[model samples]
Target: MSAATDRTATLYRMVMPQHTCPFGLKAKALLEREGYTVDDHWLKTREETDAFKAENGVRTTPQTFIAGERVGGYDDLRRHFGKPVADPKAVTYKPVIAIFAMAALMALAASWAAFGTLAPVRAGEWFIAIAMCLLAVQKLRDVESFSNMFLGYDLLAQRWVPYAYVYPFAEAAAGVLMISGALMWVSIPLAFVIGTIGAVSVFKAVYVDKRELKCACVGGDSNVPLGFVSLTENLMMVAMAIWMLRYVF
Candidate 1:
């Protein structure tokens, strides 16, 4: 209603993404009517959408906030006037724990599941997983990566190239070294890196693993869910990194 209020600041909202979801459109219309600016995250990917919900604690479409206060969705936005929003409690970012945890977990799993130790594996899976594990260990240990668990939103990892391009090759290489009786010492470190990278690749799913995003690390044939599994996998990698530190320099 007042010029000072209009000039103070604007609110932002997020919409549950669909093929051109109307909820977002309606919310935008309402904001405009109230002389408020509307920002849209589009809710395209689960990571983005989940982050939105986590930050706001709301899950429905057309989530709204003025300045900093959550004003609810479309209906809620229509009710609020152009006003500076009350700031919510601050959210902290913690990536080190996530990264190391993921590495440790994946290392453990790769040592066993991927390498026929923890859970039983088919002959093919065993052969493949062993090699995969060996290289994973090596990759995890020595790669010159500065990213935390999720690769810090790298486009390469988001597109699955790190996994498809880097991981499979590392896994296959580790597998060969083991089957062919190559240098165990060299192979151990190499496998550690491989496992670490593999884990990071999985955690990087937070970037591109949308609801419809299919995984590419397992030759289009994986049995893992998208969200929590990706996170847990990262924690596994972090653990593995710690494990490998005992062996690798």
Candidate 2:
């Protein structure tokens, strides 16, 4: 190894080793698990902690400096988990509120369909239309990173694939048809099937055995909720899709 490479072997860390500090312990344990000896300073003195934070931009302990780069706090440590671990299903995953609303609207629109419950929001499937629009907003602004510490366009060096093109476009197109109110019969079902597949696939991919892949889901937020997060999320989508499809077809 060249001198530059050899120097890389030493992982730098600074922490006020204490029981009360979550960030401090998390940062330390994570590094130790990764096989790097922590070079930490117990900053009991106010002057020392202040100087460290001022110099390093870390008011939080244990503050981590890896290879000369400052990674802040414990949540920031999740950045190391990598993007490859991203659940593919999350690509289409949406929150429960959005999913339920879409289904409710689609049901309300249809008189002939068995589900009159979805009609309130089903004006030509406007719910899907607006969702696409909002997603477009999120995609443009890159809200995914709003929740992520490390993964961002910066990580990919600016290369990115937006869901608008990858999946939302399809969702939007299908939604438009349903909301147009012309095909309450056709568009509703289309939405359901498409949404279901998207939801179910991602739910499985996230919870099931999958490889490490960076999450490209939302601009960058990788702080995921624990426990079969995939299942409930995907299930809702699948159910919404089925419900929509039921009326449209």
Candidate 3:
């Protein structure tokens, strides 16, 4: 056998009838990927698992050992190998990505129903409209929270607090109106103004000030960072407004 394949690692993981630990399986996979031969030890029962933890004085299972030294849990194993382990509290773009993905699917469905085909241009239009409506819904769910977060960066909202409160309603109204391709006079201008302001706010807060902040786009409870996703949301609205304006004129 090759020296890489001969490198040995040890792991202890729970594999009970009621609960099977996934981390243990992952750790074994990771060890194999790194060319280590894993001596996997399974704790088959709850009592056995508890007893193992107690014996080792460790609270969690899927404990790893390398060269007769403890390497800790799954995250610890990752850290040992210099792999990136994500912090649970860290802000990410996952929520926004999910929202956009769902919005795109919805747009595709709508386009298919209306045109009997997956019209790319029409789908794009519906995507922006649907995305705006969904984002507005998230804001409307907790206006107070949205406003408080919004004030952190929004130029107008910081200067005039009432704009923060009105923002969600305007977004919702514009989105709804745009979806039906009606009330261009009101929706177009509202989308344009808010989109411009939002893009500027995100840019200033994230780039200019170098401030790490949560995006208000997915609501106050979101961990979505205030950056590309937020800017994309605003840019979508701006593009939609311009596209709709051209149709009106």
Candidate 4:
């Protein structure tokens, strides 16, 4: 087929009164983004949609045709154009990277707004504190799931299941206190003890035992791997605790 012919796509999608197919919209957008001249066709009724599906031997709408050949659904079209389709179960650091990046930005913004300049030292502290709060929020959303995942590698959590449930709250408390530079007595110990325990637990699990597991750092449902990133989180908490101690002593 000619390149010009390949650039012309025929799309059949469902646009019902009650609901429009999201995948259909996605397919159209994707085709346009890839420089295709899309011949958009909508099946406005269930009967028409069913008839089209039956005639074409396809179970779903958002079907795309290129050069007289079917390219299937949205996912298939993506693959046809050599695009990477997302896999939910795949291990990735994207969540942690996003959290840290946003935390850094928040810290810098806060520093600039409050002090009228980018206070590097203050921003650094805020970054860690904010990151802790964000990570705690992820765990707090589904404590049960987080605890279950935590139990897999945390030595303390393995021995005492309740510690898993308490972990998120402790982290959050420490983070809030750290942010305010108040309640050092509570925050210091909480951060220190938990951080030390977590560091040890992660080390033994990943390095000592050489176990491969998903990290509960982002939450229980995440696909983030248990390794360097998890270890770094614990170490940062420990470091924050020590950093706060300087002010007390």
TM-score of 2: 0.34
CA shift of 242, model 1, Å: 5.8
Per-residue CA lDDT of model 1 for 1-249, tens digit only, reads: 666554332433444345555767877776776565555556676677677677777767667656556667655655565544432333212232343445445545655654566553233233333434543453445343312332333345556635433554555565555444456465456566645654555555444554423223223222223355444443443343344344435
Worst 10 residues of 3 by lDDT: 1-10
Which one wins on TM-score?
A: 4
Q: Give the TM-score of candidate 4.
A: 0.92
lDDT of 2 by residue, 136-186 (tens): 344335444533421221212224444324444444455556445456555
C-alpha RMSD values across all candidates: 16.2, 14.7, 4.7, 2.0
Compute the lDDT of residue 86 as modeled in candidate 2: 35
Over 4 Å off in model 1, which ranges?
A: 1-163, 176-181, 207-212, 221-223, 228-249
166 in model 3: Cα distance from truth in Å? 1.0
Q: Cα miss at 119, model 4 (Å)?
A: 1.2
Q: What tens digits encode model 3's per-residue C-alpha lDDT throughout 1-249?
A: 556544998899998888889999889999899889898899999898889999999999899988888999999999999999998898778878888899999999999999999999889888998889988899999999999888888999999999999999999999889888888899999999999999998999999999988889988788888888889889888989999977787
Can you tell me which runs of candidate 4 are displaced by over 4 Å? Answer: 1-6, 45-51
TM-score of each: 0.28, 0.34, 0.67, 0.92
